[model samples]
Target: MRVYVAKSGDSLLKISETHKIDLNKLLIVNPHISSPMMNITGSKVYFPSSPISDTLQTPISECPLPSPSDLLSSWIPLTSLEQMADTDYDVLIVGSGAGGGSVLRRLAEQWLNSGKKVGMIEAGSLLLPTHVRNIPTVNDTRFSQYFHTVSKWTGKYLPDFPGARQLFALGGRTLFWGMSAPRMDDSEFFDWPMPLKEMKYYYNIAEKIMRVSTAYMEGSSIQEILLKRLHENGFPEARDVPTPADLEVTKYGQIHSDVFWSSISALAYALNRMPFDLAVNARAVEVIVEQNEVVGIRVMSPNKRAYVLKAKTIVLSGSTFETPRLLLHSGIKGRAIGHYLTNHSLLLATAKVSRQQFPEVLGTLSIFIPQTKKHLYQIQMGGPGGEDQWYLWYSQYEEKALLDELLIGISAFGKVESRFENYITLDPNKQDKYGVPKINVNFSYSKQDTEIIHQMAAALNQVSSAMQAPLIVPNNRQAICLMPPGGDYHEVGTCRMGDDPHTSVTNRYGQVHGVAGLYVADNSVFPSMGAANPTLTTVALSIRTADYIVNQLK
Candidate 1:
């Protein structure tokens, strides 16, 4: 028998997997180990001396082979750009955010064992395997610090949109999103090229996979009282926010470690159904087009080497900023490639409610006021404290000094009209290390938009007054602060969808206008996202686009 010494963090199951031996066989050989799942660190474990297989006779090999696990990543397979250039892919998705992830997941489910080659390339490296909230060690404060370290404050360069920040990672911005998954108002979708009925069908599927739930405020007394107060007051439509959070209990072998769903969740689902090649730090410099037909992509490695990846179908999900930059930089012809930029105009305020307002059992308050025909903005109210608020990475409960105040964060998002003046253009003067042109944002509010912002601010005042929680202005802050244009991180419509090629970048199916086999499936495709958060709609449209690509392949 082979005597193998265990190192730190080595478990019996991991050892059995590393040595290609069954758990029972390892247990039989060494009775000292209590369980197969127990960690055996700095200890000797007897392994099966000879290799065995399911065949009648003992399995023998003439040539020695390395471990089956991927050296770069054990959870999912990773291939280099050099290797990817050798094979043609049926579908190659750019970006790994909500849109790109949903597309990959749906395609993997629909094309399982179909012998189709699907690949994905991300310009950023693997930042986190799951949503930051799923990590146990990351509390709200820690998360804030870590996020600042990993994300790029791109807004610093855009004078008009100073609040914009970019996160280039596997899961994208969903890693730190508020998780409030609200669909756009039915009227808001009126201008979109896609049908409303079809949108509803896909929305249902997206909700199921993302685990949208109102169970968060189930037993919270604070929410109960606050909700009742808002309903009785002018705002009767106030209710618990639908968050894409998996709160189900883990049973059997299924571990529900993913409390908050993100694009990494989608990636995991896709990998389970089918195998796909993934390459991080691989940037798509240009989309190769020939006579108005898509051919492949010119991708660059981190080391400045370029590789030509042949893919008949390419979906650009690099987001509102990056997608349009790629299209314009690649010289793809389209009038609306980088126009009609839109985002929710946000306002922030906080208030302190008396602790005597609710019962002794005080829980967090999280509610949303949806957009209505009369009101063009939506409101999100949450929290019982500044640091000890709900929906953090990992909540903590501890005894502290008694207080008579309840801290609540109030925010409103007003619908910004999609306009040609508000656009993103390639800044040829500035370039990254890869020679990719940086983006220059040109944005401002119109008279109508300013009116809406004023309305939103008034609504906040009214809501706060109605709740008996007067809005409080902190030191060096105004009574109601209007967040910067890009602060909401909801930018969209740069490459909007429409029937007219002269006015839009992608068509109804997310395919790039006048370019065969090229598609755009991120927030950039939204004609008008309204006051709703763009995550859910982005995913739904992506799923539809993936289906379109699948049907086209057949």
Candidate 2:
């Protein structure tokens, strides 16, 4: 395939005609390149068809030509017919969230050193803080969008789906996470078909590369109170034992701190450190599989333009919904492609507390409550920016002077036992622009989950009574915190990892057992939802996968 750049007079239509390719076809490859209404100048465009033989020899000196292998080939879209085909890569890592981002960085470093090409593809458009803050409506919560989507409550009981649940931006959801990095309980791994010892080492390696820190929690009032209460109430504190220099801080501190200070942004800044190519705003529509082995990925961009990224190794890090949707569209159905989906359950119970100011809480410093005894064991912490409004009240919305106190938002997360009832399916008639089926995420709570919520709420109420703070449940008027499937970016367990490929999509190493050079390194591969945030574990698995790949290459 050949590349082209635009001149002052080159409109997409004119380019297609001059290159002898269909104009309509050209529009497909460059859907979003156009602005909200018209085309934006100096924006990179991708044409769908290949260049004609006559047009290939016509070189314009105004536009610089680059080698096909060069990462920045050209800004022009494909314009020639018959040459619009898929490109191949040594490794094609999908998604760009925690799992995909880490693996891409690691592989890019290794591949650059080895003089091999590695390709990283992200479905969402690249996220920029400057662009977000510039937008008028979203400026106030620009930070939230920078990180992850907000949670919503449905009715008074069920979970509500938020308009902004998942952020489809360049860094994936890492931009919004509170950076709570806790390792999965040994029991969580024991339940899986793989050995826990191997996973532990991987987790350690990932934590190190991420530079997880606990310094953010040093003087946090919320962490202190929660830790003291847990200890005083006979609950166990997060393990804070010392480790070697190689393993610096406590796992809890390493995982849960602010992800704004994460390695992801650094990798983005060091894009030149990569050997192959990183394509943002490119959405993978389907995986090219032949004879049960993965071959390549077909993607569609905002311009409705289609292309392929063929690879010897294919990694699906498109999170839960996207990964499964891609596989299903690719006709690689499995027993667990979209089953066992789980996310942390949250409830926003506000109250009028005696204290006007809420405690200065560190993100993710939760009180761990064990469920063995069944007195409502949970990990509770402040909600997104809830600490800021702790002492403020709504003078306009509520009874003015009756209760002008601060509101605290606490999230109670517990174990979500797997259930087949909660799963993902393709919407029958709803097709995306690519003509692929849109995902229908069926997020329902099992009796066990509902019971757990009840138990957690009861325990929280007990704490409130002790503090003499009257609980103020949000009116069933609208959803607040408790939201349905895909609410939080913590979705996992679709392409599960286990010992048996017959039952699991990928093996413990994240390799698709039946297919060589195919791996699933994102949250979708988790076999079980541990009672902790999944980012740390996902990062660990990505690091582990990178090491395995590096060793294999050696």
Candidate 3:
């Protein structure tokens, strides 16, 4: 359990050579250190299995060494419910996904030196320490396989919501989310309950914390040439996709090992600000309500034992599906608690382009044709990838023996209307091991939704043709493929936010109607899934909600 505090001018090479530890073993144990040449100053390098003998020579350093505790410790500590039950929390977050994580980040940032108590409970145990794509070993193929293995396919029980899946880990689905962190168009929020001014203010904060940048593809030749083609040929709205990545370098003994952003990243920021009680494998089965206010949450342990954790406020970020289920199970009075389920109508088209179309240094492509007044869908085109449209940077692929074509994929997300008919309700006949009833979904695309899908298909064609990439269809498949509902993994609006008690579960501030201290902050709170990825907007709303909660406390 011995740890080394990395000092200036010290790296894995120097430490390995000086300490007589195998260099390969050092990398194996310290996954946090991405490269041997990285400046690991202010980092705690562990020697979990290495043995240090008394006969070994004393280590010499170019710079003064830091105390063990002075260096950065890269571990999230968990507190058991047995102890957590004794102390009350100011805010108890139900799930640790993007929504819950953002709420925790804002609160911890604001209350860094304060004594405000915060607690978070996650149903699943710690999975990946960061985003799956951030890991060096994970590529496109392994990414899909690994994600499928970890996440719970909740849609299996619901025939209508067959594509629905839930990853109940500490970081939730963010571990596998594609990092398209675009802000919803200002026009999209024209009719929202909250003011556009507040939404813009929170979006800036969310993007700042997430390190959202458009420079990821700035220097890439492939992106440059293809995007130019799109702009020249009718699709002038195309631009570089906004990616959530920490492009910062380490400096002055500070470490920046985590490059890709995830909820785990948010949790890390929160911990750096202040310690919060985090209990994993703690499934929230019911919310305890007193009169019309939320009192606490009844959480079930792995062994089926239930514990009630007291909190002045509770934010449900369990997700679009799980949040509604919990509300219905608790019998919380909300006419729209589980109604108005909505997801984007997804359309996909893939084509092959000549590899020689661009310069030899073929970097990856990520172009975004955003949702506009004329078009209700946004198109994200990326590739020169392999067989499908996997990002070439993250996946390994074999060259096409007969052809010199590069694969390009365009995904169009068409905005679907949030209808009251498409909703989720608990199945009284089914109860899980924790004694909570399962949820059933009644979802179908309306005529307007189907028309949007057609429009998305035409748009995808125009863009692909603009890039001079001929669309290719798989055997017996249409050129424009319409993915099933919920296939996008961007389902939303079950616990939508609005001012009406009968039409919305939570108000614009995210508080549940008629219920004080109960809030919804996940994808569930989005009134509509406006053809943009919900992660970025969800984080923005969660931050705004956190600010509201802070004001209430004050």
Candidate 4:
């Protein structure tokens, strides 16, 4: 067998044409080659000893291709706690959510060619196929099974507020995110530490990598009606939703269908194909700091074994709650470490869409409604409210009769002003099973938040009236239903970024204010939580931070 090193832009077709071997033969020999157009750069390809007949025919039943699991299993081997502790790494990332996953991919791609080692520690176990393949509802038991054990809040300030849901799997909460990736408007970035231009550049990079689709409201009839209504009301900023999915294109060049949105699990699977190390079920206990600098991290394995892994740089991408808990447990002190905790106030209002008027609109379509003088909100048409047959039966309506009654829901995410009172602190007397400090969360909405919710309710009522669709009132509410704080799961502003070290925990580049070689790349570092969802912005910020770290290392 002859070995051929695949270069950049090398494809199986090109290799077959160059070597004068049949495509089927090439695929048969290299079972790992899933697709002909797949880029196998920096890898070795094996050729047969002699070229077979040009007309060689292989039986379809005889040829077996590798499954996604097979391919993923062969990508990278999971490192054991002992193995990880034995070697020092150039960069160590904690958490594998969108922020940490993006940073790891960016840095690993740049450092892979240089032979620099990059390590990632995930507190949760590896995500199983059952977790990724199923789309369970929020109330489903499977949903709870994927989260961390300590996913609830305990504190005096806990109001009727919704409890925090923490997912500690390979991709964190991103494995079950709504996949709404909207760019923050200019007004929303007023409180951001960096300039909008710099942030926009990183947003472009993140959108490109995540495959955020641009064709938003092309085929949805509900979106068309909403756009017309917004235009008639002089709100032109209400545009099609930007999601991380590829739209299905037709033969006539019209894009109409919606695909599954991108997730961090897919990104992690791709990154695992590269040269990197990932340790799962390894909970980070503390940062091994020496002389005011981070040198390593202490982690406990699943079997109660502890290990200390050395690294030149440590990045904390744990969620807002866990990140602050880790820092506080490590004896890192800052007034802003766990202060300014904020999440958007979620208000959901639903109305039945006239299916007779638009029978073609079947799936959901998201639209952003930016308020010039108030909080920005999002409107989604054809949600999951009126889809289930069991729900129709329980509501005393036949499923066949409700075929023309699609549910259109609007979500208004009010901008909750970050306050010092809404914060998370480590419980002095409590500890989790892993011997880590338990977190006590204290968060509540302000008066302004209430005002924004009222405004959003009023706007939703106007839209429902304009559409001539009656509101779906389940709880006998006069207006919209206001969900508790943290309902959106868009918590941020804990470890805020600012120019002043005393007021913020991290700088503009996400590096720690007083601690060297320590950085934060998750929503915990957000200075402000705009009405927009935090996933896209968190990813963009993480990419920028990764670029900065690469430059600093160089």
Candidate 5:
């Protein structure tokens, strides 16, 4: 194969795939390649005839980084373009969400240090501007209105507030995440297809990189009383768990923040300064495959211009919902593509409390209850009483102090079995402006879900009574704002990873069974949705993918 040079918006995975060449072989021919740190649009690279699949099957002992000379040689003017040259890179990463973001951070530090050209591709606009937190309220319209909806390339609309917000902006969904960074229990990780030990280590590494912190802040009187009551009610260990941000201050005395709103944050925090080709406003249209192996992808820019990219290896970091949609569009029909979908439900209960009782509650705190083996419950943090009305349900408590400052919010996540009824399909009759099918998500809760939430609420009320914060559990219909199928926005398990190729889309190592050099490292690979936030786990799996890619490259 001839050497190829990447031009404007070119990706390595798209190129090698175009010629049916192995990604490792292509990189072998051109050993000195730039990392995502550089945007080497005019850099030259070699293409080899042998398939990387054969050579890369054997695991390498260590991951190597590119040399300084290689980095210099691969440096192309950020503005330069030379599209038609043949060059090979060790790996190519797609998407810049939790999965892609974590891998790129690791790869840039390790493999890229060995002087290997690594190409990272992103197909959404950079919604976040530099120096975001300094801009006042976190609820600023820039983040709430524009950044939220603009990232979506689905070309279809969902319910306004919560649904339409899952856009494809620069940091992906990380920008608006509640920053809840809970660790997955051993049972959660052990149940996965891959070994649990390595996964736990990876989770730790990812948490460090993301600067995840634990929850902190003074607990409200209600929280204190509730815990005491739970103890009295035979559940003493159940208490509120802090968020990553809260924990940083509480546990480590650190006030670290997150780096998810921008791709730049992911690279910059790692202290990396390489030029990488990060194309914004570009949407991946299809996955191009030949001989049953993924080669590259077709992308459409905001201008409606279509471009084809070839790469030796392709990793899909799109979220759970979109990942399956992409695979199905590319014709990789697996039963697991859009099955076993799970998202935590938030059930809001209202009550009236005295204003004097509202002084203590600070941040989002939660009390977890592991009910039975499969069923679990959580009573989230809140204030006074009627405050739940704007968010959950209205209140009519009489006391002046009680009725005025009453606000509460709580959510419970119940693990549900994968059912055929809960699925995703392209609305054949509808299409976005870009002509992609409008995604129609059909999701509802089982009776078990309802039972758990009601039970959780009863427990919460008992606890609140100890603190003088009584709650009125409304009918399910009235609590619509708090508990919905996709309330917490934690969606997972669309394209699961497993040992059985016949039943799974990706293997334990995240590699697509039939497709060489193609892997998915996102919530899409989750087989069973554990009763916790999915971001940290997604980060861990992505890091694992990075390690796997590094091994194969070596």
Candidate 6:
């Protein structure tokens, strides 16, 4: 036997191939090795005394081997066109975003050992590390790097209105989300089909999977001072913002909080131990329904070739916009197919905290102040850009002086009442690259929405005064600035969930009304937009839906 020191990126398979030994012999000699595919960098590997060609020259009948599919099960294999063709799946999940990803995870966990084929098809490409690593600045010119403007709605709304932004990747928007994991208030679910008690169980499961913690940035001096001030000033709702971040303090007291940005890709990656397939860059053009039951989906590939994927179950977890467009294209007629659209009204403000007030302040701190009225508005005490990098990106050049001693942000997010007028419809003339009709959003703020914004702004000002911080105005603005509609990117309520089939698109369990085996699990199923971020709720509800589907399959 010869000793071999594995170099970086050296796997057992590579080592065995390089050493010209049979994989079984290599494993027999290296009993301490845990996995054959694991990168055993800097580890010692033993080589058997066998000629390199001996194993290669062996008869295939004598040398039993695992199949190629068995060897590739360590990772979720990205399916190619040839592999996806002429195949059937037990469950076909469309849109590998947050909701879709969560449902896939739950289903994969439940049916991992059951040999059930759960296939996930995404309209976008695989989310690469490079795509999210180099996030563009919030400047107007560079904004298109991460966001695309809806061409049809460009000239319809006000000039100041910022159009909706959608990310076309395996993880979808979760790749670039702010990682806020706040839960909805019970009152927010008053119109939901499921009760609050059932949702709480799923919320607990999601919180664990996402690693959500309210103690994020707990030991920071700035957080301590801010929490004390808020509590003393009678703002009980001003507590630590729940986030999927792990806080680590160095011996030198330097704070480093690592955010846990859970995406669909992460969920798929975690299911490596399970058996599943994920097909990327496959956009669903239509659902093949027979006798009001979905049997297959007509998908178009990047090269414009269309094919049918047969499945026992179908789920549409596409975002609020794309899901509706897919349903309309599939001839799923309903009054609420693309209506009752709602998103949060965002108001951005900034404040400067003098160094003299609290000298021990360091790093960023976030706190949420909930309003007394249910489903009204919540005042967030941190900037959208969580870290110092984002702080420098959005802050004005003139405010550079206050960078060392600035609190820098206040945002008021008010719930928009769901109205029938705020709806989406397929455009008659416009079509995207896939020859599908483009979506037309006919939405405007209601009178109650305007009043809520004014109230939220005043409340933010009150907090600024109590904290003894002054406004940091950019462009010499004297008051709070309202960001254009869809700025928050928390759009929901397009395919709302309710008990009535005529009024809503999906039922309590996310099953499409009158369409067996067709489900909707994304934010499009929201009945109303709660003040909290919708990602957590979307995930929790998806978990619930997955359980329902599993029970039905049984």
Q: Which stretches of model 6 miss by more than 4 angstroms?
A: 1-76, 129-161, 246-259, 383-404, 476-478
Q: Candidate 3: misplaced stretches above 4 Å?
A: 1-74, 395-403
Best by TM-score: 1
- Across residues 74-168, which tens digit of lDDT does each residue of candidate 5 receive? 21222111241133545666687778877777777775447665565566655554324323343233444544445453323443213423656
Candidate 6, 74: how far from true, in Å?
Answer: 13
Model 2, span 1-554: residue lDDT tens: 44556666567766766777766555656676463234344656565534443455477787777866565333311111113234456677777777887887777666666666567767665454322322334422344543444322221232332322555766666654655676777767767866788888877776666665555354555446545654555445532211111223348555322223343543553365764466777778888888877778787777888886678788888777778888778777677778877776665455444333344333323333433434323444442223333211111232222223444454556567676556777877888677888766666777887887677676666555443445665655322255444444577888888887656788778887677787888888888886667888888888778878777657
Tens digits of per-residue lDDT, candidate 4, 244-340, equal: 7654556587543324343454455446545677898999999888998889999998888899999999999998888888999999878788988
Identify the superior model by lDDT, candidate 1 or candidate 6. Answer: 1
In order of listing, the candidates' clash counts read 0, 34, 0, 0, 55, 0
Off by over 4 Å in 4: 1-76, 128-161, 248-273, 359-363, 371-402, 475-479
Q: Per-residue lDDT tens digits of candidate 1, residues 32-95?
A: 9988888889999987554432332456779967775624454557888988999899999999
Among all candidates shown, the one with the greatest lDDT = 1
Q: Rank the candidates by lDDT, best first.
A: 1, 3, 6, 4, 5, 2
Candidate lDDT scores, in order, read 0.88, 0.60, 0.87, 0.74, 0.61, 0.76
Q: Cα miss at 554, model 5 (Å)?
A: 0.7
After TM-score superposition, the amount by which residue 542's alpha carbon in candidate 6 deviates from its true location, in angstroms, is 0.7
Give the TM-score (vs. native) of candidate 6: 0.79
Residue 433 in candidate 1, Cα distance off native in Å? 1.0
